[model samples]
Target chain A: MSDIKARVSFLGKSANILIWLLLIGACAFVVTPLLFMFSASFMPAIDIMKLPYPWVSDHIHRQNYWNGLRGPDGSFVFLRNTLNSLIVALAVTITTVLLSSLSGYGLAKFRFKGRNAVFMLIMATMMIPFETIMIPLYMVSMKMGLQDSYAGLIVPFLTNAFGVFLMRQFLLTFPDEVLDAARIDGASEPRIFTHIVLPNSGPAIATLAILTFRSQWDNLLWPLLVVQSDEMKTIPLYITKFMAETHSDEGIMMAVAAMASLPMFILFFTMSKYFISTEGLHSTIKG
Target chain B: MQYNKRFSMEQKKAVWGWIFVAPSLLFFLVFSFYPIFNAIYMSFFKKNLLSLKPPEFVGWGNYVYLFHSKTFWQSVSNTAVFTIGTFIPLVVFSLMLAVFIVSRPRFQKFFQMALYSPAALSSVVAALIWLLIFDPRGLANQTLNTLMRTSGVNYHWLSSSSMLRLSTIIVYFWKYVGYFTVVFVAGIGGIPDYLHEAALIDGADSWKDFWHITFPLLKPTTLLVSVMVMIQCLKTFSTQYLFSTSGAPTRPIDVITLSIYNTAIKDHNIGRASAMSVLLFLVMLILTWLQLRIAKTEDVTYN
Candidate 1:
């Protein structure tokens, strides 16, 4: 009886170990490309396409990193583009969060005719893919003389349905008593939002900010459509153009990718816990 | 008299709401709704870049052309296959991972963080990383070759057309699994522990308990996840463009969105592309509405 119990225990332990191994193996599979990308950024152009094996040189070509930093003509185009992307992303985040919060507060706190209709309209917009309207939107931008400008890139995406939806969801949970107290104190509607509501909704605001920033930073197609000049190129477009121009220079391409991804990686690493928790917050608002 | 008081309050509220939501509504109309209507209108025209003539109203010409085009049908089939291929495996793996991680509460946090990290990375970045791996001499093939040396059988994972599609689907699953897993974990966590406790006391096995207790409770979450996944699959373009070769056996892997992009931007056939986009939109809208209806039914049953 003791032997049988021991056997069962051993089998369970083995099964658990197998499960761990399988999980780890799957993770390794997913991580392989990212790992290779980092390593290949250090390899020479000729070596990049070569089969990575035991024969593959372990030597790191440091020049690839240097060449990546210094452009073909020794210009700071890549760095400038990186900075451009950062500024645009930050601007997008700030505008989106502030506007969405204000709008969300208005929708949530105010009782008015067609309030539900307005909210429904915003929600409906969320389903419309940008691809469906790319041409006319581009034409409109050109007609407004906003072509090749940051204003053009920023304006269309400034007020997102998703951000408004998220903020509305958060604001719904705001207690009516808090607003009543503020009203009783003779605070104006805008003042109540600024002093009372905004101060209290830090987590939701942060989550919206992160999501907005990430979306803008990684936005490719729209930015590609709008930004024409090299000066206006965001990081993704910069990297894509760089890849096309320097097709043979894998090292440089990888280096640029690393640089492009670094800021977002830092932001994500720092705020991942908050981001994960916000999923629960979404459920609460959704519920 | 009571109705008058309520009406006044509602009026005040409505004014505030409209004032606050005005900017969003304006942008939504200009950038979203107007564009959609414009695209629908454009779909009926025969417009070209060189010919600045008034768009010749050709009702259903673009749509008819789209239906007749082999590439369009091919794109539809590819999208369906890609959607189904990625969706099923992704949902299953994510649920399993969530369940496993949640089963052991001690290491749950670590597992959750590890799994969720990939989701934080953008789809573009994720695609780039996978492209590197699935390149001919890249890590995936290298590792496979090393493993196969003992048996003397080598395999090309990405070079072959079918394998390329399969590989792309796998990458899609890998990138999105964490996102759905996080959703599932949140959903599972929301399930009250009392139900599970009662089931345990009733002598239910783990699987039986999950079937009876956990599954029913997760209906809303499953609905939400399914809707999001379906929409996501519909919008998939960048990864396919990045990974697949431009022409030939691999060329057929181009999905509907990519085809629309090719037609509009590359081929400069904006009218036809707009037609395809309108069709795609309608299909997605119908699918979403159906899912919501089903979810409503499930909500009623479960509650």
Candidate 2:
């Protein structure tokens, strides 16, 4: 009995070691390409293409960033594109948070006729892929003279059904007695929302805001259709253009990719807890 | 007087509800509902994107043309190949990765953060990074050559038909595997601890306990992940688009969305593009409905 127990303990120890090894390997697999991108961003183009490809640069070359940002004619096209992406993403995020919270509150708390029908309508649209409707949407944008402008990008995606769903699921569990007390104290519905609902909805708002911002920042298909001019191009388009013009220079392409991904990385690192939260994941999948 | 006052209060609440939901409803009506209906309507008309003339009605012409077109069929097959090749491996490996992460409580957060790093990248950025890796004299070939003890043997990651398809799959898998793993981690976390304890008390080992208890309890999450993966794979556009534009052959990787993009933007064939989109929408709808039906039957509610 003593010998068998010793063998069992030894087997468990080996299994634990194997698990750690597997975890490290998986992490490395997920991270290596990113490491390569960062390393390549500072290397010369030739070094990047050399056999036994250079994992690190001998010297940190800042020239690639300068060249990548300043276009062939020295116009800061990449910077302008980054600004456009920021503006669109911020506008969409702010409006989506405010509007989604309002709708989510109303749908979750209040009793109203046609509420379910309205919700069903919105949820039905979530099933329809944006590609299926792009041609018509493009036509609509053209008719409204919204093509080639920020309004064209910002207006169409102000709020999505998924945000409302997330917010509603969150607000459903909110205590109604607080709102009732506020109402009994002569507070209007809007006042109750601004003062009571918004303050208490930190997690849901943060989750929705981050998701909205990331989606807008990374949006490619709709922007590709709406923005025609070089001036209105967003980061994705800018990167594509840079890749095309500087096909031979892997360093410059990597530089552009690194710069474009910086904001998302920062956002993810800061609010990652919300991203992997069981509540958020549960609501997202429960639908 | 009391009845009238209560009636007015209920009416006031209902009015406020409408006031709150109005803006989003209007936005969706114009942006989502209108476009979906309009796409279906426009599929019957022959319209040139650049032409100022009125659209000429040609009911079912575009659909018939698509059904017979070899390029459309090729795109269909390519999409099927991409979806099948990617989603199965994605579901399997991400689940495995999730199990590995969950098994080790100490490293769960660290492992999740590391795996989910790539999902934060935009599809364009993801593809751009992979493009460098897939270059002839890049990391992909170097690693393979070193592993196999071969010198300067090019794998043709971008040029060959099968490898090109595989390259796109690799990028997508690398980007999303962590995301779904995180989702799976959340799913597995939802399983109650008492069940595991009971299994252990019954002399069931970890493997048997997982197969009999955790896997069955995780049915809803698995269905959700599979459907989400399927839908996302069907809608894959940017990677294939970027690869084709970067001089890789378009024929092998031209999925439906990319084909729709080319038809609309390159060829200026609005009617044809609308028809293709409608067909794609039907596929998504059918898949979503199928999932819902299966979910209804297989739902495992905890008492």
Candidate 3:
């Protein structure tokens, strides 16, 4: 019996080590593409097919960044596109957070006619994929002359169903007693929301903001239709058009891809706690 | 008089509620609800995307045409193939990774961040990066060659039909597996620790514990992730779009969204595109409903 127990323990120990090795291997597989992208971005050009795989460039060539930013024709066109992406992403994030929080607060705290109906209406739309509505949305934008403008890019997606759902989920857990205390102190509804509720909603707002900003930053198809001019193009659109139109060097293309990803990487690294926390998962998962 | 004052105050709060919800409701009406209705309406009409003339009423013409169209059916099959191919591995691998990460003795965050790094990047960037790897002389073939001790063998990753499909699946898997894993980790975290403890006290082994407890409790999360993955895979556009436009054959990778884009913008046939959108929407709706129904039946059996 002791001999059998000893063998079982030994087997479990080996299994645990194997599992850890597998975990490390999976991480390596995940990081390899991005690592390759980063390494290739710094090279003038790489013989990517070289034996043993040139996982790192021989020398860090920084000019790829300059070349990438300058566009294929040396016109510095990508700067404008990057700025457009920043503007749209920032605008969408700010608006989505504000609108979602307010609406979420109302539904969570108040009992009103049509409150549940309104919440359900918004949530039901979550099932409708953006692709389903893309054609008619494009037509509506065209009819409204929203195409090829900042408004066209920003207006339709100012708020999202997920944001509302997330905010509501968070707010439902907020203490009603605090709101009642504020009300008893003669604080108005708007004042209470601005001072009391908003102050307490940091985690939810952060999760929602990061999610909204990331999505808008990476938005592609709608912008593909809405923006006709290169000047108005977002980063994803610019990258696609650049790749298609320029046939630029691989190094420069990787540099552009790296630049596009840098913000999200920074965002993830700096605020990663929010990302992996239950709050972040809460944003995506149903309650 | 006192009751009347209290009643007015309750009414006032309700008014504030409406005031707060009005903006979002109005935005949804214009951007979401109206567009859905419009897409359905437009599916029955023949219209040129660029033409100023009024649309011609075609009734069921667009739907019938799509039913008979080779390209439409091809897009549907491509979408089905991609969705099934991607979501199964996605659901399984992510769940496995989540279990691995959660069970680990250390560095859980490091594993998660490493896995989720790709999720942060745009699909365009993901596709572009993979395109480089899929290049004939790129890391993909080089890695394969070295691993197999073969010389100068090209996998034809982006050229061969089967290989091309596999390549897209690999990119998507890399991008989203970490994301779904993180979600699953969260789901596992939500399982009460005392249940695990009780199982241990009752002499349940780890594998049995997971099967009898964690897996059953994780059903909702698994359902959620599967549904999300299915919808996302069905709606996959950017990777396939970038890949095809970058010189890979369009026939193999021409997903529904890409087809919709081409039909509307390239072919200038908005009516046909709208009809396709409607069909895709129905497919998504029915699949979700079916999944939910299956889960419900299984729940009954479990009890």
Candidate 4:
């Protein structure tokens, strides 16, 4: 019996090691594309395709990075576009978080007529694919003279259903008595919302802001349809334009792509803890 | 008198609740709900952008044409393959990864961080990076060639039509497995440890415990993950656009979302595209409803 037990333990250890190896292998496979992209960005134009390994070259073509940052005429077009995306993302995040929190607070804390109906309506909107409405939205944007403008890009996404849903859910965790106490202290509803509620709901707001910012930054299709000029292009649109115009220049294209991803990569690596913890908290809060 | 006053207060509370939620409701109606209805309306009309003529009512003509079109049918099959191909592996891999991570708390944070990193990369960026890696002389092909040299195994991983579909599925899995793993981790973490402890005391092995306890408990999460995956697959476009070569191949990789993009943006056939959108929406709705039903039945059985 002891011999058999020992064999079983040995088998389990080997199996666990194998599983760990497989897991690490999968993680490496996932990161390989990103690594290759980074490597390719530093390769010379002539060496882009000459490869068993793209990064096996003797010298790194650092000029590709400079050219990527500068435009065809040596202007800082890429930096300008990145700035535009950041601005739009930041503006959208702020607007969305504020609106969502206010609305979420109302829904969670207040008892009102037609409240369930309104909430259900907002929930149903989540099912409607944005693609189905793109054309009409385009026409509307044109009619409203908002095309080619940041306001057009930011305004439409400001009142996000996901944000409202997330906020409402978070607000549920707040004690009702606390709000009642504030009310009895003659704290006005708006004041309670601005001071007590907003101050306490930092984590939810942070999650919403991060999600909204990332999405808007990466938004491709809508921006493609709306932004006509190269000046108005966001980073995704900028990379796409670079691809279309310079299909032959793999080094430059890869360089631009790397630049587009750098900010998001930094943000994600630094703020990953929030990403893991926020989802469950939001779900339970929403429930 | 006090009871009557409290009832009035309750009514007042209900009124204020609606007032707070009104802006969101209005925004949804005008922007979301209205556009969907508008798409349905647009589907019934025949109007070309260049002609600028008022829409001529076409009734079910658009739908009938869509059903009859060869490309539409091909796209439908492609969508099915894509959906099934990506979802099965994604679900299995995520669950396994979650279980592995959950078992080892020491490396849990690191694994979770690494897995969720891909999601932070924009889809466009991900597509661009994968495009480079999947190129003929790219890392994937180069690695395969090296293996072929050593092992005498030669295969076209992305050149053939079916192989291309498989490649796309692999890319999809790599991108999404982390997101779903996180979700599953949340679900698995929520399962009480006492249950696992009890099973251990009863002489149940790890595999047996997982089958008898963990898998059954993760049903709701499975349902949620499946639904999200299906919707995501339906919306998939940028990766396909960036990866596939232009023009038809022996095995087509055209999915429904790509078809809509082609018709609307490339072909400039807006009416037909809107019709396609309507059909896609209906299909998604039916599938979602079916999934909900399956989830409900599973819940009943488990209970």
- Candidate 4 CAPRI assessment class: acceptable
- Model 1 spans with C-alpha error above 4 angstroms: A1-11, A46-57, A280-287, B1-13, B147-158, B244-250, B290-303
State which docking tier applies to candidate 2. Answer: medium
Q: Comparing 2 and 4 by DockQ, which wins?
A: 2
Q: Which structure is stronger by DockQ: 2 or 3?
A: 2
Put down candidate 2 lDDT per residue, A1-287, tens digits, no spaces.
Answer: 01211111213667768867877887888899999999999988988987777687787877988888886658998899999999999999999999888899889988899999988887777777777888888888999999999999999888888888778878999998998898889898999999999999998888888878887888889999999888999999888777777788888788889999999999888888877664324445322
Model 3: per-residue lDDT, tens digit, B221-302? 7887787788789989999999999999999889999999999999999899999999988887776565545434433322
Q: Order of candidates by TM-score, top first?
A: 2, 3, 4, 1
Write down the worst ten-residue block by lDDT for model 4 chain B: B294-303
lDDT of 2: 0.85
lDDT of 4 by residue, A1-287 (tens): 01211111213778789878877987887777777778888888678788557475678888888888996667787888998899999998888888899889988999766678777777666666776678767667877988899977876787777789888978999999998899779786778888899999998888888888888887887887789888888888877767666767778878888888888888887887667766652242111
Candidate models: Cα lDDT each: 0.73, 0.85, 0.85, 0.76
Best by DockQ: 2
DockQ values for all predictions? 0.37, 0.50, 0.48, 0.41
lDDT value for model 1 = 0.73
Q: How close is candidate 3 to the true structure, as a TM-score?
A: 0.94
What are the TM-scores, per candidate, against the unseen true structure? 0.90, 0.95, 0.94, 0.90
Question: Candidate 4: where is the Cα deviation over 4 Å?
Answer: A1-11, A54-56, A281-287, B1-15, B148-159, B244-251, B287-303
How good is the docking of model 1, as DockQ?
Answer: 0.37
